[model samples]
Target: MRRDQSPFLLANPRRVHAAPWETREPDQAVTVVGDFDTALTEVELHGRWDPHLKASAAHVLRTCLVGQPAGIIADLHDLADPGGESAPLWCAAHTWGAHTPSLVPVVVCLPTAAPLAALITCRAARWNLPVYASLPEARAALRSRAPRTDRLTLHLAPDIDALPLVTQTIGEACAAWHMLTLHRTACAVLTELVANAIEHAGTRIDVAVTRRPSGLHLAVQDHDPRLPHLAGAVPGDPGDSERHGYGLRLVHTSVTAWGALPTRTGKIVWAVLTAKSAGERNRRRPSTIPGTTAPRRS
Candidate 1:
């Protein structure tokens, strides 16, 4: 992406590869990957029972399964967490298994991270999922299954003033394809992710939105160094009463992908939006409406 046009673009050295990238009408299949596919989809847990995290993980697995005719395989053997638990990753894996047409997901765990190594070891001991320590090894298991493709990574930040711009952009992108629901979802996910990043991550925080052919990406990075936890989340009292948390679950349903990143300072909570554009025309609306209450611009 060209940063000379925007400050946010500076942090990311992307080519925005679709040029003469004609601001041509949005097509459901414009960019290669939206967000999650852009990188290894990941989640970090401050607690063991995070429905939000679990639901988000399932969404990514489903995204990977789209347009494919085989099982979804992911590897977590190479992830940087050495002391975490596979139990945390199970939520995503199980969720993916339940919804998608596959029983297993290719999980790659990077053992370089001591915490991750321990986590994977324990999970492997408990389950039958194949665990690997390298990306290539993880890819090899799925290569013959599906033709791997391009990936894109974008950032989403909650902006009090950018809603209109975002709405217009998304509305234009999805309306052409009759994917109005996706537009509504983008609005909701952006609203919550941005709000959560700001309210929990603290000020000077900015929501970054990145788009690719496969999905839309959003993240909020803040200066605070503390890991964030929802104010009053409790483990499964085992009831249908939804887990009392923020709108993240809602976000999990709206987008095709989602995940979080840890920063040296504070953490960056991000989500990948997996939707396609087809040039559906429409008008602009509030960026932070309904499910979204704008977080103070960082």
Candidate 2:
């Protein structure tokens, strides 16, 4: 994949015409572009939002929400929904986001004059979806309502050297956020994730560390669609590859919860390390990993 000129573009390679977080239809009737600025993920919708675009748009929103961004700003200024038929979509999205363990905030942005503005306010009123006239206003409102989070991101090559860099970054983030207790586990989880990508994916990687109120969030994204799964190895047995299920096994034991999500270009393996009690951690685990089906070879 060729790199684009978007400032947000990192090591994770994407299509020449689209950013890693962007999705569009062939006819270009609708486009969903997501931008992650450490603190939040901004999803901008362009073109018509009629029935034809509803399914694609919902998928994009679900993908963004699954990544557990601290907050979301859904920009709909350019989306035309004259009849407000898309109001239900926004309502469902907000409901879904709120139900996440993190309770990720999802806000909408559109000019007051836009046809969808009044409809969203009236139809989505029960969901209490915040609607803003501008991005700045929406961002400010979300920042005020959402929990404060700190984040660090690094774009690295798929090499063994990236391990130390990722460890160093995680150490710094944990220290800076006063999460020294989680530093070791955080580093262990992140390094294993990056190392797995380096060995199997052999593509550029984007590593991100986010400090949330509950714990540390670590994610490693690579340009390979193959999802990681726990090898069906008997306990106390180190499978054939020497390091075979070792990395993911360590990650599974060290983190409170871990899973993978497919991206436009590849996949992101993420884990959360928390100091909470085991009971609380159990409550945080999702019934199933998002974007994951039965395990399969790449």
Candidate 3:
């Protein structure tokens, strides 16, 4: 969790985006742009609404929220009304945001003159999230509102022997930042992420943690461009209760926010956890070096 020395002189934590938005497929309906630290999901809602479209869009938006704390943008430029099944799908998107851990879904209704723009606005209002009429305004608002904090990155190989070192390093960093309360959650998250990489991806991993203004941002990177997605539950399925695919689910329940995104080389999965409380922060802020105390002011 140590900061890598910058080659340049000035170091600004707010300017660091460890994972920027880069997409492999140019034709995807839902595109995720950004990394664990900050991201924007642009979804183009065109064509006739079908069950396949609904499922696909839902899956994409879920993955976007899972990889990054930010929400997705529903682009309604080519439609007069969502009509048919897509309207309900939009409601489902809003419901997903409400149930998922993070900001509500954002909509970009371009040109202001699109026939269904006003209808889209009304629909999004019912979901309680704003609909922007311009792309620049939407991007500007989302970018400026993303978490701005210092980030520390670590690189490790795909070996089980390295887990201990990774855990200890994360614990030390959390303690140093008065975030000792997050040590357990951080350890669990890091372990699950690294283990997944070692078993499935079998590639070197890059782990980064950013201490945000109010919480912690943890991202795990591996050389697998395929995004991790949740499997649908089957009725009366024994595997539903089994722990095979429960690692990320545990993460989803433990943290305040979590998401995943595709990197140029691989994929980065990230989560945001609540930091120590005011009282705990106060207690840990002073008392360093075992017995040292701050000098009293006159």
Lowest summed lDDT across 10 adjacent residues in model 2 is found at: 9-18
Count of residue pairs whose backbone atoms collide, per candidate: 52, 0, 7
In order of appearance, the predictions have TM-scores of 0.37, 0.58, 0.51
Global lDDT of model 2:
0.65
Per-residue lDDT of candidate 1, residues 15-128 (tens digit): 111111112222211111212232233322222223443443444444434322223334443222334544456545645544543233445445444565555556665554
| lDDT (tens digit, per residue) of candidate 3 on 1-298 | 1122111011011222222222233332434444433445566644444554456556665555543345566776653343433555566666676565444455554556554555555666565555677766776777776555456777889887767776777777787788876776676766766777777788988888767656676778888776554434546867554544666554544565565556556677776677543224235443311111111110
Model 3 stretches astray by more than 4 angstroms: 1-34, 44-46, 50-68, 77-105, 109-112, 118-137, 147-151, 155-165, 202-204, 210-217, 227-265, 271-298
Which numbered prediction scores highest in TM-score against the true structure?
A: 2
Give per-residue lDDT, candidate 3, residue 65: 51
Each model's RMSD to truth, in Å?
16.4, 9.5, 13.5
lDDT of 2 by residue, 185-280 (tens): 566667778878888999999988987668777878888876676655556755554445766765665565665645567767777677752233
Cα lDDT of candidate 1 equals 0.42
* Model 2: residue 253 alpha-carbon error in angstroms: 2.7
Best to worst by TM-score, what's the order? 2, 3, 1
